[model samples]
Target: MEKNNRTIVNAWCMYDWANSVHALVIISSIFPVYFSATALGASGTPDTNFFGLQIKSSVLFSYTVSVSFLITASLVPLCTAIADFTGKKKRFMQFFCYTGAISCMLLYFFTKDTLIPSVFLFGLSLIGWSGSIVFYDSYLPEIATEDKFDAYSARGFSLGYLGSVLLLLFNLSMILAPQFYGITEKSVPARISFLTVGLWWILFAQIPFHYLPAGKKKEKRDGNWLFNGFLELKKVYGRLKEQPYLAKFLSAFFIYTMGLRTVMYVATIFGATELKLPSQSLIITVLLIQLVGIAGSYIFAWLSGQIGNIYALMIGVAIWIGICAGAYHTTEAREFDIIACTVGMVMGGIQSLSRSTYAKLIPENVTDTASYFSFYDVTEKLAIVLGTFIYGAVEQMTGSMRNSILALLVIFIIGLLLLYRIPSRKVYHLKLDHREN
Candidate 1:
């Protein structure tokens, strides 16, 4: 209800600085390339046998990601409900952080012969990362006021982009010129990078853990947490049915995230296999994406202040449609680089704005915002499941990824139509009830 404390805000943003290294190094840049290039068998082909079917390595990677998302999507709601009911969100957050960082550290030993364990640990780390975010996002409203939601949301993402890039740049040098660091084996540098990311994730996470509010317990923890959580989700769903705008916004968010996150998840892989970009070149282009993303977060925040949240998101969706089409058409390495840059420019904007917009739109003065955001998280992860699964299945069937890229276009168009139906305003407010609440 008052102005946000500077130290507390910085601490909250710092966790983004900490955990984002995992996102960049493990999920986006280094691991994907490392798995494709160095984690292969004696035969030098990026193919793997799964259940007697031979599949390309990248396809298996996407499928693995889908499985991870499915696991996370299924588990997060009850965890958040337990956190909501018990007021121990900080504990839940810390537990997952440790799990992920430890899982990441174990990746240093991964090789061709260790494929099964590698995939299992990778999925575990994803669950850890996704699980921690359930509570991390709940802290957003606790730290900032309604007016500051968009700006503060943008600030968190900006910090994440900047921090991850700093780590990525340092790690890139080792991967490129391992001899400079006295690394003889080609895979050693990448493995060492994975080790660094794990240490970075764990050590820096303590900042927010020390300062964030332990959420207030609403009810006694005497019942079955899993079953009570389901009740909580059912209650939130009932509330949403009465609020058309929030319901509409979430529906759009769910559909569009299927396209947006799938692209983000698979972009680096596509650049390598489809665009035929080298590992060095792919990481460099990804680096550019992070650099531009810092500005993109602020740019969209300002645009939200100027044009309103819903309209700004529509424009972002339009840009995404172009990006998907462009990716489908562009073949040259340079053209793909341009697509990567465009993605960077709009990616931060859409993600930050979408988050803050939903925060602002939540039922005013509700303490159980975690349940609302849990619904949001579930919507996103499930969308990802469908998107990545479809992407992989289409590639499996048609024997080409070209149609896979085009499929995102249809998804975005649906989201754009949903967004366009909302009434235009200069800005949204917490007073959806017009002071009646």
Candidate 2:
């Protein structure tokens, strides 16, 4: 019943802590690195069969991500509509959460031989993780005040970074010291890590699952879900059409974050296949990124207060541009680590600020939080679809992921230009105030 109770807020943030291991272990660190190595045999040919045709494994992995997001983008709006119409947000969130955890556990069986099944399971895990977050993010405006959005968002990310780092350290210990665990095959440790990540996700999620409030009790009898969802989406679009800043910000967010998401998704692949960095070094590098991102989240949240979210995001986007350019020229292990660490510095900050900024932008009176946040997430999934697809396509065509860097750099530049067109904090507030009064 309380609006900003510490207990409720902490419970909400714990969801971030729950699901973040998926980001660290599955998507970012161990899994991508493992996939690349597994696909590239001892002879080191990157080509693998995907349906009778040979496709580069890294590019296939990229397509996997893009496809998962495409499905997520399709499903999110309809799911959110159901959640909002029936006030069953908690139920929908739990469904996705458990689905993702089980999907992740199934990934323990993924090997070079079982590539297709594994890839689909991996896609399912992605869909589940991403879907739950849409419902989770919609809770922000309902639970926290505008002034606290940045702080709460940053804190949530900090907790996620900390929890993910702790789990990753455990997984790394197993991977790096397999003999100590009596593990014979190198792949065993990584496979075990996948199963553990799923269990961890399910375990930590209970804390928030028990504490966060379930929404409206009203039940909808209409079975026309597609039609009903379209109606909800139409309302959301109408609202955005009225708010120029929100619409413009969404555009910029989509463009720049497309590049950002692609880099995060494929950075491990690049390091593994392109830079020829060992898996150990790649995972360690990710750990470093996670550790630094813990601080980055709070740092950018504070910076947002000082200079406004828009300007702070612009600065972060500029840094991302530099990262892409630097990565293009990087050939050594040490140089790649530098680029990765720099990515950490802005990764959390940019993401946290973006979510909070969107929360702050949404008018206070609107109560269909699930539908609104789904629209925001739809933008993200679409961006990721385009970004990862382009990355894969470029790599497949050019025989190198380096060409993808040029594409990402261009995306950041366009996003920054669009961001520049938005009104400053003072002007944005005046506009919001004018609307309110």
Q: Pick the candidate with the highest TM-score.
A: 2
All candidates: CA RMSD (Å):
2.8, 2.4
Evaluated with lDDT, which candidate comes out highest?
Answer: 2
Quality of model 2 by C-alpha lDDT = 0.92
- Tens-digit lDDT string for candidate 1 (1-437): 23488888888888889888888888888898877765454586766765666788778888888999899888888888988888888898999899999999999998877877888888888888888887788788888888898988899899999989998999999988888899999888888888888899998899999988878888585678789888888888899888888899989998899999888888988888777789999999999999999999999999989888999999999999999999999989989999999999999899999999888888777888788888888888899889999888887787777889888899999999999987655644544656667
Clashes of each: 0, 0
**Superposed Cα deviation of residue 436, candidate 2 (Å):** 19
Ten-residue segment with the worst summed lDDT in candidate 1?
424-433
lDDT of 2 by residue, 121-193 (tens): 9999999999999999999998899889999999999999999999999999999899999999979999999
User: lDDT of model 2 at residue 132?
Assistant: 97
Off by over 4 Å in 2: 41-43, 218-223, 426-437
Clashing pairs in 1: none
Candidate 2 versus truth, CA RMSD in Å, comes to: 2.4
